[model samples]
Structures are given as structure tokens and as C-alpha cells.
Target chain A: MSLITPEFGLLFWQTLIFLLLLLLLAKFAWKPILGSLKEREDSIDNALKMAQQAKEEMQNLKAGNEKLLADARKERDQMLKEGQAMAAQFVEQAKTTASAEAGRITQQAREAIQQEKNAALAEVKNTAAQLSVDIAERLLRRELADPTAQQKLVDEYLKDVKLN
Target chain B: MKRLLTLLLCLCTFVGFAAEPAESGEKGGAFNPGEIILHHVADSHEWHWFSTDNGNFVTYLPIIAYQPGKGVAAFSSEKVAEGKTYGNFKLEDEKLVAIDGSKVYDFSITKNVAALAMSSLLLVFIFSSVAKSYRSRVGQAPSGLQSLLEPFIVFIRDEVGKKSIGPKYERYMPYLLTVFFFIWFNNLLGLTPGAANLSGNIAVTMALAVVTLLITLFSANKNYWGHIFAPPGVPWPLYIIMVPVELIGVLVKPFSLMIRLFANITAGHIIILSFISLIFIFRSAATGLISVPFGLFISLLELLVSILQAYIFTLLTAMYIGGAVEEHHHEEEHGHGEDFGTAEQRAGGSNVAHLNRPDVATH
Candidate 1:
């Protein structure tokens, strides 16, 4: 029972001192400490948020780079296909031109050969006639060795010319 | 964990074993363990350091008293050291009083008062320096005493203060921190030799409780009062029964707070003193072999209790404040249930875990 007893003097003094202590501490100690703590907390939260934002931005950039690479690959494939088609067309054009030119040269050579053969044939006919004429003149010269024969031939020739 | 449980089991066995003889109030030789413990724990006019065969070593403090007709009177407490009456006043059972048996108001600087003043000064000294470092070293890591105190300060702020007090925790931080360190430091000092059990004194605890009560009621908004007086869902007839219970609850909360701290600290002191008394009771110096070990173990346990009780006191204070200033209608209207606060704390059982539970066996 004595243990639970309360004295007025102790109560008064304890209340007075405790209230004074509370007032003093509330003014000086708690204000600054809590302020600094909250500031640090806010700053930490902000740093984490910024880091997350930066990570997302990096992911966006990586995706963009991949798309650009894919586009570039597609463009290169199209250009290669076009180049191959043009090369095939060039080969086809070259073959056709070469065959046409060869045909024209062959026809011209055949015409030239035909003309040369015709000229050679005409020269052969002329030679044969001259040879025959020479033969006949020689025969006549031999036969007209006598004067009477020459007169007879001349008269023959004259008579034939008059009749003509 | 098993180990801890065994230690706790041994502790409880020892405490239960100790409480028997203590409550029985038996006497051995000329020494009454109860008297020694009570005297040591109670507040007095002078500080008693120790006693020798020839004399007692004590330091006198100032005594301030007020009498109805005398207005105000101040003098050194030593004037009544020899049990002499001074100015029609004498020291009766360590209390200053008038010879006429009239009412007197005593505001003396007793031993506990001096201790309270000194501890407050110590707080100002330690924390003012810490506050200075906070200003100078913004965004940098803590150093020195600031580092040591930061964990506890942060623990109270985050675990106890913010978790329990919710969004408006900032407004109550000063009171919470002050009460925590004040109780904790006083409790630790009480464990030291030649120091009064400041927290063990009912008057001191009551003072602390009164402040808590004042803060809680004043901070309570209309919604809190509404919940108490008119309640939300109960039928009108139940309010007659419900309102009185709620009102009684308000008084019971702080009353329990006061008694909890006082009884715990006082019981610890009594148990430790009884263990020491066992040595002297057997009239054999050799009994010290057993008693001293037991005493030492209990003393070590007391060291843990010193911090635990302080934390419990502050945590309860925060909880009471939380109940008072808590915002509820928004949640009720939107069917958010009792879950409030942010995403982190809104997690399951957090509110109940923080607000309602007590860590009785904290060590």
C-alpha cells in the first residue's frame, strides 16, 4: 500500500519539470532533426524516380536503333535485287546486237562474191570469141596465099555486104 | 530463437520465484528489502549516494514550499536534515509540511527533479550538436553521436511514429521524440547506483501520461469525437451503452499508460533488490555465490527493460495520437475499408500490427 502512495510535493515538482523539459525539447531538438530527415527521404525518392525514367528512355532508344537497322537491311536487299536484274538485261541486249551485226556482214560478203563471179564469167566469154576470131583470121590468111583466092574472097565479102 | 526462449523461460521463473517473498513482505534481520527498495525508488529532498558504518553521504538540494499565509518560502533542504522543524515546518516522512497541519504546495528541487533537469540539459547538449551537424553536413552521411542516435531516432520516426501516427505524423514528432529519449534516458539513469527511479515514480509517470492525454484529446478532430459519441453504424439505442464505454476508454488509455511504465520499472527494481537481499538474509557471505549471479542476470535484464519500456511508452503515445487524429470517413465512404496510408503501409496487417500489438517480451 505504501508503495502506491503519492505525495503532493513530488507530483507538483515532476509535472513542472516534465512540462518545462517538453517545451524546451520541442523548440530546440525535434524541429531541425525531423526537417533534415524528411529532406533526405524526398531526395532519395526523387533520385529513384529519375533513374527509372532514364532506364525507360534507354529502352526506347535501343528499340529505335533496332528498327533503323531492320530498315537498312531491307533497303540493301532491294538495291541488290535491282542491280542483278539490270545486269541480266544488259547481257540480253549485248547478245542480240552482236547477232544482228554478224548477219549483215555475212549478207554483204555473199553479194560481193556474186558480183566477182559474174565479172569473171563475162571475161571468159570475151576471151573465147577473140580466140575463135584469131583462129579464123589465121585460116583465112593461109587460104588466101594465092591472088585469085584473095579476089574471090573479096568479091564474096563484097557480095555478102551488098546483100546485107 | 530457442535459445532466446530458454533465456526468457529462466527469466520468468526467476521473476515468479522472486515475486512470492517480495509480496509476502517478510523481514530478515534488521533489513527490510521492501523498505530499502521503496526508499531508493521514491523521490526525496536530498540525494543519498551511499552509507558507511559511521555516516551517510548525501547532497542537499533546495526546498521550495508555499504556505497559505506565508505566500512563498525557499530554503536549503539540509535545514531539516537532523529532523528539526524549520519555520513551523518539519520533514515528515521525507515530505515538507506545516506544523499547523494545513495545506502546503511543495515545488522543491528534489533528487528526481534535479535528475530530470540534468537529463533535459544533457538532451539539449547532445541533440543541439547533432542538429548543428545536420545543418552543416546536408546530404552527407552521419558522423559521431549523430550516427549512434540516428538509428534510434529513425526507428522512432519510421517504425513507431510514422507507421502508427500516419499522414500527420510530422506534427507530433517533437512530442514523440522528446518523450522517448526523456523516458529512455531517465530509465537508464534509474539503473545506475545512487540514482532515483524517476520513471518508476507514479507521480512522474502520471505527469508524462497527462501530457499524452492533453496532446491526444486536443489533436483529436471532430471525426474522432463523432466516432466516439455518435459512432457510425450502431443503432441509436446502442449509443447510450456505447458512448460511455468509449468515453471511459479515453481515460483508461492514458491511465494504463501511466501504470504500465510505473509498474514495470518499479517491479524490475524490486526484483533486482530482492535478489541482493537474499545474500544478506542467509547470514552467510557465501550465499553471495548464488545471489550475486542471479542479481547480475536480473540487472542485465533490467538494462534491456530500460530501453524496452521507453520504446513501449513512446509507441503507445504515438498510437493514442494516431487514433485521435486518424482520418476515416474518406475510407469508409469509398469502401476502402480500414486500410489507409500509402501503398507500402497499406499492406496486410500493417495497421493492426503497428497500432494494437504490444511487444511484452521484447528482449
Candidate 2:
């Protein structure tokens, strides 16, 4: 059996065929196949990397948005506090002015009442003097009842005035 | 109905063709199992599918021989039917030797060559179709044969090429893919009834290995040869011992590549043929029960082995070339050669082994 024996004919033919097949396949089949395979693999890698980057960017954006929201909330609280303090200040100023005006008005009323009291006493004195005079005059007029008696009284009064 | 009739007719025709061979082979004699197995595995100058009672069926291939005096003696192999002579040349001891005891150079298209041709044509047709599909169906789900072959193509590239060869895998990919399909298809062809044992032939294996060796050697950078001749981290006195050792390894690598494929394919064929021969040796109808099932089991195993062998061959080729052309930076980055993964470690990885690799998985 020539089983283990390496024949020259088969060896030559096989080599020729193998080389030819390798060259032809390399040009036609493998070139395109390998090219496409590489193309697909590279694209897949790119897409994965891009997805990872996008995820990171999304996380960053979320954090930034939170920070912005915090800032806006802080500014709003500051504004509200300032607004409340201004309102309290206006209330305090209005109370002070109103108290001053009320005090001045009360004092003026007291002075007017004092002046009216003095005037009322004076009027009472005048009324009392006029009442005494009217009473004396009524009594004298009753005592001297006739006209002759009145004339003798006038002469006696003139003499008495001269002696005085 | 017409399709059905045609199918039935084809089935009948095949049965007729198949049936006649057994009857003639019986007349031919109870087959010697070992010889029969060897005959199937060897190269031949004719293509014999089967035989009939009237006459044996064979497609006589062309005989191409070159002798010193005759220059070139080319003729149809039919001239040497039953080992006849033509122009002082005859098939002597299964070789195209001159009848006058002169040396002759035979570069004939034997049965294995025919197998190679057939497989090549088939490969071209199949791959071109897949290529066209790839071109037209970019980014879409693969359908038909494209779907079937795409995963394998991707596996060879990623697992075998990218894993073992690292970044420079693309350069060697064309040759890798070519050899992968070539060996794979030929191995498959060998399994078919009436097909030549293409990958089983030692010549075919040697040719493929030679190509790998040539590619590896040619692409080898200074670092590769340097390491082989004078390895780093070894004592200076050890160069005397290590240089030859490393050199033998360089020689042995391709030798192993050749033998592994040849032995594996040849063994599978021998086993299958032996199983088939058992039925004939026993000469009992009942023997089919013992023979057919065993043969089938072995054949099915061969189906996996054939593809596996092809993958191994291509993967090793990539690793070799990867080692050769590897930039020194790669080893530095990975720490060392063996640290990346020994060839044995890579072998344990089946066709889908890339799925398990942490690096490949990340990709």
C-alpha cells in the first residue's frame, strides 16, 4: 500500500489547486466578506461607545437640572422673605403716625373744654348780679308808692349828696 | 404533480444506480475491509461512482506525465483502463510510471483534484451569493443560506481570528476564511457517497499547511525570528539547548498542522468505510443492523469533527501568523505570549468558544 508514501503527482496538483483557490478566493470572496465583516464589527463598537457616552451625558444633565432648580428655589425664598419684611415695616410706620395724630386731637379737645368752663362761670356770675339788682329794684319801687312822695325823696337825696 | 413525478423518477434512478453496484461488488468479491478503506482514502486517476452487471462505471480523468525523453505525455486515463499502457507509460503500482522503468513526473487531475475543483466552484458560488446578500441586505436580518453561514463566518473572524491573532487579525482573514471553507467543504464532500476524500489526502493537507507556513514565515517580523533563535529571559548558556528546541518547534508546528488534518479526516473515512465493510464481510442481511447504525453514528460524529477540524486548522493558522506578525507591544501589553492563552487553551474553545472569552464578550 502506498498509503504513507507521498506521491509527487498528487502533491503538485494539490499545491497548484490550493494556491489558486487561495488567490482567487482572496480576491473575490474573502475581500468583500472580510471587508463587510470588519465594517459591521466596527460600527457595532462605535454604536456601543456612543450609547455609553450618551448615558453619561444624560446623568450629567440631570444633575445640572437639579442644581438649577435648587438655585431658583433659593432665589424665590430670598425674594419672599424680603417682601414680608417690607410689608411689616409699612405697618409699623402707619401705627406710629396714627398714634401721634390721635394724641394731638385729644389734647386740643381738653383745652377747649377748659376754656368753655371758665366762660360758663363768668356767665353764671353775671346772671346772679342781674338777678340781685332786679330784686332790690322791685322792693324800692313798692316802698315809694306815690309821685309826691317820689319828688320829696329826690330833693332829700340831692341834699344828702351835697352834705356827703 | 409533475414536480412529484420528477422527484420519484430521480429517486428511482438513484436506487437503480445504487442497487447495481452492490450486485457487481458481490461478483467483484467479498471486499477486503482494510484495502477498501485505503482505496477510498487514496488519490486516483479515475472517478468511479458505481458499477453495473454489463460494465463498470467510471469517468476516466486525464493523465498528465512528464518524462525526460518523451517531454510531455498527456492522454485520457481511459487509455489505461485496468492499468493499460499508453506511449510507453502505464499505471505501475498505482503511479503513472513509464513501462520502460523510467522516471515520470505525473501532474494529473486525479479524483482528489476533481474534488478540489468541485469544492472550489461550489465555494465560489456559495460565498458570492452570501456576499451579494451581504451587499444588498446591509443592517438587515440575514435570511436563507446567508443566515446559516453568517454566524460561522462571524465566529471564525471574532473567535478564531480576533481572539488568537488580536488586532492584526484582519490581514490574515482572507486566507483564514478561504482555508476554513476550503477544508470544511472538502471534508463535507468527503462524507458524501461517491465523493472523493479531498481533505483526507496527505497531499491536500500538506499543501494547506505549506501555505500557512509560508504566510507565517513571510509575515514574521524581526521580533518573531529573534525570539525563536534566541529567546529572552532565558540564560545565555541555554541558547545552546533552547535555539534548536525552538527551531524544531517552528518546523513541528506546520508539520502538526498537516498531520492533524490528514490523520483526523483519514481516520474518520477509515472508520466509516470499515463499518460499511463489516456488512459485506459478514455477508448476512442481518449484518446491516450491526453495520449501518455504527457507520451512521461515526458519520454523524464525523460531521461535527469535520467542521471542528477546519476551525482548528484556521484558528492555529491565525495564532501562528498572529505570533509572527505580532507587534512586540502586544506581548508587552498582555504581559507575555503564553499568558494571552496557550494554543491548547484556545483548542478547548469549541466553535462557539469565543462567547466564553471575556475579551470577545466585551466586544
Scored by DockQ, the top model is 2
Residue-by-residue lDDT tens digits, candidate 2, B158-203: 7888777775676787889889999999999899999998898888
lDDT of 1 by residue, A1-164 (tens): 53577667777767766676667667766777778877887799899999999999999999999999999999999999999998888888888888888888888888888888878877776776566557547757886788888778767765754674
Worst lDDT 10-window in candidate 1 chain B: B14-23
Whole-model lDDT, candidate 2? Answer: 0.78
Give the number of colliding residue pairs in candidate 2: 0
Window of ten residues with lowest summed lDDT in model 2 chain A: A131-140
Chain A TM-score across all models, in listed order: 0.52, 0.52
Docking class of 1: acceptable
List RMSD in Å for every model shown: 12.1, 10.6
Native contacts matched by each model: 0.66, 0.64
What's the TM for model 1? 0.76
| Model 1 lDDT per residue over B1-363, tens place | 245236334422211101111212333247676677777777888777766544566777777788888788777777776577788778887878888898888877778777776676788778888888888889988899888998999999888887787667778888899889988998998899888888898888888898999999999999899999999899999999999999999999999989999999999988888888887677789988988898899889989998999999999999999889876645333332223333434454565555532221120
